[model samples]
Target: MGHTTGGPDSAKRRLRRELLAVRNALPADDLREAAAALARHALDLPELAGASTVAAYVSVGGEPGTLALLEALRARGVRVLLPALLPDDDLDWGAYEGEGSLARVRHGGRMALFEPSGERLGPDAVTDADVVLLPGLAVDARGMRLGRGGGSYDRVLARLARSGSRASLVVLLYDGEVVERVPEEPHDAPVHAVVTPSGVRRFS
Candidate 1:
């Protein structure tokens, strides 16, 4: 829940379902192609180029792939922090070493997730990141993100706010996921930009 689905959140609930259907309906081949294109566009972002640490998550199901970009970031000597979902829907961070550094974890009612297995750096680890790559169904011109309704990333964003972190918030999505407007609430914090298969759009 990237600042989503709790405050003025009902409208987003319907919108999330609609956007999710469109994303989940893509052909296997199209999903693959979009992942590659998305990686290409994302890797070119200036925010990521010189970032020492980035908080990111693995792409699962119909979500746009981030494996390529993860590998590229690791190869650049960047510190990549991935989230391990907690029972309370909050997140704990861990350093992503490589493909071998990940372990498969399955939470009840959730698909298996590939998480960093070495050590747990605590939830506050995200505050130290230079950029935080968020997962979302859609991003509006206002940079408001519609999350998966779990509220995991919502806690992440809230934690960052409490600590007054300066990390650049970014969302990775498919080309069509960028939209005109999205429901927003008091808890919603606008993202800095969005990266898609087509290109990157920054918001003030």
Candidate 2:
């Protein structure tokens, strides 16, 4: 009934709508529990093990929470870099000090985002990360991630590619967000793994 096919863009649009519905339908209590479970599972990721610096983002809306994970990584002495949205939809990086180090910023007519308030490093700083945590709406069996229509992370991926970064790219999502398939384009690159509250999935 919804966009079943047509082209990649249409397919993505339909999937986004469907996933958002599922995400927004989560109960507050359930979301809180999921957040804690997500941190526990994500902390067990091999990609994050022994990493000195990890690039991450703050979860907003009903997105799988990363605040706990960030704190855990910091406590482990991992340098956590968070993304700060720029006017051109690219990201600027900043160090995560703690929970109080974040600031809520509303860009134009968009919903507010929790961003690091520390000194900003240029977007290229992400290239130095040993691991990069990505936020997504869905990830397929092949490791391709379906993000919100914003195209922000698309630029981040492009930047990493252009720099020849070897950082392990990981996506944090709820268990149900992992799917059998997702629409993709030629520019789409597979992630190394996906971490859900239930467990972790890796691709070859």
Candidate 3:
């Protein structure tokens, strides 16, 4: 048999499982309060403060909450764009109107996600964002983010690069999710900053 349990890929998988277990163990009340605090800290970032448009996602299950941040941006007159998962795992964009505008969608055998229910703005819409908030399980000291392994955001990053977008990329996570290091691949790109319930950390 060939070896399949080594290298950065396997390390990422192991770390993701461990992080998820801790997240899932959190109390509902704790998660709710963390969500509120996460929003407050994220809104204070200069990257989001003067942004005309933001591309973000609706957190699901044990992931760090983003609904509060979404509403705050909308109220600030920032055009909030939420992702709609495509069959190919690519993401399409849509305007986030509010709580009423999101539809719960289940992608194949994956968990149900709250996505925008309005008109599809196409994937290219993300290029217009001044900031893009990524949902991640963890961020390392070097600002490498560990995503859900859906490859959706990878495509988004590629698109941004192809289009020469200057959008500041940020990740939202719990305080404990900020660790000393996370496994990284050659294609992986480091984020500009991370927003946790406790505060924000930026990388050069």
Candidate 4:
């Protein structure tokens, strides 16, 4: 039998501890350099090259590398879509034209940058995306992601799977955060690729 009796709170605590430990273990310089290298590799990927529309997340905490990657993609004329967190477990896609194009939108206690003409769509919006960049605490060799205990990306990817969409799911992590395997549940969504500052890793 599996260890299934733990509640959400317990699971969240464990996940947080693991993430903190991983972050602390990484060297600061190595982490930053790796992030830059990964961003370069991601941009060079054939699937991402010349892609018009891409879906990405706002990096919080130690995930600052995403900001640089977003800037680069915008400079290259890729239409970037950022997640606008909404109530009732819904998400809206907002175009990130550039830094100056962002307008404040309130969600819970925080404000997110959004574009005026962005389309407010449901989970099905993943199907329309050419690529999806995911944020996670840790990722495994097989592309399993350990998020902040929220099922947001999982639910969106599930919808894409059901619709037979071809969007690539890419998870970004610090190099040390990539592990052999992570504790996963049935509902956990597997990513198509794992990217670190070192390189782009294709999971088996």
On TM-score, who's better, 1 or 3? 3
- Looking at model 3, which ten-residue stretch has the lowest summed lDDT? 1-10
State the C-alpha lDDT per candidate: 0.91, 0.92, 0.94, 0.73
Model 2, runs deviating above 4 Å:
1-5
Error of 3 at 168 (Å): 0.5
Return the top candidate by lDDT.
3
- Candidate 1 shows a clash count of 1
> Residue-wise lDDT of candidate 2 within 167-190, one digit each (tens)?
999999988889999999999999
| Clash counts for all predictions | 1, 0, 0, 2
Q: Can you give the TM-score per candidate against the true fold?
A: 0.94, 0.96, 0.97, 0.80
Which regions of candidate 1 are displaced past 4 Å?
1-7
RMSD of 3: 2.3
Ranking by TM-score: 3, 2, 1, 4
lDDT of 2: 0.92
Please, what are the lDDT tens digits per residue for candidate 4 over residues 39-104? 787887777885788888766545636767888888888878888665765566677766665566
Clashing residue pairs in candidate 1 are: 1-154
Q: Find the 10 residues in a row with the least total lDDT in model 1.
A: 1-10
Q: Which residue pairs overlap in candidate 2's backbone?
A: none
